[model samples]
Structure formats: C-alpha cells, structure tokens
Target: MNVSNLCVLTVTVICMVLAWSEPSKACGSCTCSNGVVMSCPNIVQISLRSSGLTNLSGSAFQNNKIVTNIDLYGNQLVHLPAGLFKATTKLQTLNLRYNLLVDLPDGLFKATTELQTLDLDDNPLVHLPAELFNATTKLENLYLSRVQLDYLPAGLFDAITRIKVMYFWGNKFDHLHAGLFKATTELESLYFVRNQLVDLPDGLFKATTKLETLDLKENQLVHLPVGLFNATTKLRKL
Candidate 1:
C-alpha cells in the first residue's frame, strides 16, 4: 500500500480501538479509575449500590457532564460534599436511598437543572434546605419517605412546578403548609402515610387540580376541612 493509504488505515484503526474501549471501561462500574466516576463521554448510568461507600469527594463526578442516572443506594454515606454533581448538568435520576445521610448541603443540585427523579428514601435526614431543589425545575418524582423529617419549609417545592409523584411517608410532620402543593399542579400521587399529622388546612389541594391518589392513612388527623379536596377533582383515593 502507498504511504498515504497506510496512514489513513492507521488512523481508522486507532479510532475504532478508542470507540470500543470507552464503553468497555465504563459499562459496569461507577468509576473508571482512582475513584473518579464516569469519566467516559458515552457513559450515562452509574450504579454503585451497597458498595460500602462512606464518603465521596466533591470532584467525584467532575467529568460526568452528560451522565443521566446515578444509583448509590444502600451505602454508609453520612454526608456529601458540595458541588459533587456540578458537572452532571444533564443528570436526570439520582437514587441515594438507604444511606446514613443526616442532612444535605445547600445548592448541591444547582447545576443539575435537568434532574427529573430524586430518591432520598430511608435516610436519616432530619432537615432539607428550602432551596435544595431550586435549580432542578424539571424534577418530577421526589422520594423522601422515612427520612425522619418533622417539618418542611414553605415554598420548598415552588420551583418544581411540574412535579408529579411525591412520597412523604414515615415522617414526623404534625402539619403541612396550606400552599405546599400549590405549584405542583400536575401532582398525581401523594403519599403522606405514617406521619404525625393532626389536621389538614383548607385549600391544601386547591392548586393540585390533577391530584389523583392521596394516601393520608395512619396519621393523627381528627377531622377534614370543609373543602380540602374541592379542587382535587381527579382524586380517586384518600
């Protein structure tokens, strides 16, 4: 073969090798090397369930700009450093269930604007920052069950106007704000079971016109408001 043709062939072979190696290096593991997670451009999912992870560095996901799903369930993590997900701008699903987390840092998801589902179930979280989800405007499903929370700040869900399913079960909250679900007009299923609720405010579901299932079982509620469910025209369960 001529020198020019051989050079083109060599380049093609190198490109083919790189294309095959990127996914092979990142397909089944959370980190490609040295605890740095998802450094590959084609990798979109990272699963590190029950890996005994206690802590993560702030630059853990620094190279995962296009990662969409991350599952770190059943770990021993008590806290996450700030800006951990600063590079994961297209991240959509994040599952941190069954961890030892007590509280989350502020603005953790500030750069993760496209986040859709966030699962924080079975953690020891005692409080959540009001602006935690401010940048996650596309968030839809939120799982906060068994987090040991007693109160949620007002306007916490104000920016998540497209939220659909929310799980607030097994909490210590005795009451909820009347306008808690006002911005979640597209809310469909709401689970508030096993809480310390004594009463519900009027117009609680006024803006949640599309709410369908509302599970308030096992609470200390004494009576329902006169028109609490008036605006929840599609409510099928209570």
Candidate 2:
C-alpha cells in the first residue's frame, strides 16, 4: 500500500477505536440505551449487576440525579464513595447484594431519603455505622442477611419508623439489644434464622406489635423469654 493510503487507514482505525471507547456524554460510565444516551435524560433505573466492578468513582451517577432504582448486585465492590448517591435523592430501591463490601460510609444514603428497599445481603460487612440509616427515614424493606454481623449499634433503625420487613438471617449475632426494634412499630416480618443468639431480650419485640412472622430457626437459643410475644398480638408464625 502507498504511504499516504496507509497513514489514512491508521488514522481512521484510531478514530473508530476512540469513538467506541469514549463514554456516553450523558450517562458517564454507566450503560445506557443508544437512544437514551443521545437524549441524555429520562434515565430512571440503573442496573449493573454482575459487572465485575471493583470500585466506583463518586461522580459515577452524578448526571442521573432523578434515578429511582439502582441495582449493583453480584459485583466485586469493596467500598462505595461516601457521596456516591448524593444526587440520587429520588432513589427508592438500592440492591448491593452479593458483593464484597466490608463496611459503608456513615452518610452513604443521606440524600436517598426516598429509599424504601435496601439490600445488603451476602457481603462481608463487619460493622455498620449507628447513623447509617438516619436519613433513610422512608425505608421499609431491609435485607441484611449473611453480612457477618455480630452486633448492631443501638439506635441503628431509629429513623426507619416505617420499616416493615427485615431479614437478619445467617449472621454471627449472639445477642441483640433490648430496644433494637423500639422504633419498628410498623414491622410485620422479622427473620433471625441461622444466627448464634442464645437468648433474646424479653422486650425485643415489645414495640413490634404489628409483627406477623418471626423466624428464629437455626439459632442457639436454649429457652424463650417469658412474655416474649406479649405485645406481638398480630404475630401468627414463629
């Protein structure tokens, strides 16, 4: 081939590669439909499950301010930037399950006040900040199963007064605080299966009057506390 022709072909190939590698101007690094990326608006859901993501930049979703649901399930994320979701104020459901998260920032969900369901299951989390859910006041369904938690800080769920379903299965908890569910008056289903709990505090479910299903199977409990279900009038399955 002539030198001029070879040079032109090389430049054309490079341009094509750059065009394909460049991220969408609107969605940043997040995947978006061709039409959506061109328009750069109306993005409501972000699903990046099983994408082998190890970490995310703080500005990953900065342009997706009105996004409502974000699914990052089955990834390798070890930590999340503190203000990762600062602009996602309208987010309702966040799925972080099946990741390698060891701990989360205290105000990770501060701006996600509209959040309702949060799934943190199947991670290796060791500790949780007491005020983690303080700003998620609208949270209802919480999934903490298999996170390797031994103890939960007091007042952890104080702001989630509207919580309904909670999953605590497959943990290392030996005992829980007496007032753990003090603010979960609207709780309906509570799962504590596959834990190391020896005995439960008598008033643990006192404030969970609306609780219906309590799963305590596969625990190390030797005896039940007297009047444990006294206030759980709506409880049907134990």
TM-score of 1: 0.86
For model 1, how does the per-residue alpha-carbon lDDT over 1-238 read when each residue is reduced to its tens digit? 2223322332333344345766454233332344454345665666766766777778677776787988888988999887889999999999999999999999999998999999999999998999998999999999999999999999999999999999999999999999888899889999999999999999888999999999999999998989888898899988
* Clashes per candidate (backbone, < 3 Å): 0, 0
TM-score for all predictions?
0.86, 0.84
Which pairs in model 2 have colliding backbones?
A: none
The candidate maximizing TM-score is 1
lDDT of 2 by residue, 1-238 (tens): 2223322332333334334554343224333332122222455666766766777767566666777888888988998999989988999999999999999998999999999999999999999999999999999999999999999999999999999999999999999999999999999999999999999988898999999999999999997889999999998999
Worst 10 residues of 2 by lDDT: 31-40
Model 1: CA > 4 A from native: 1-38
Q: What overall lDDT, based on C-alpha atoms, would model 1 receive against the true structure?
A: 0.83
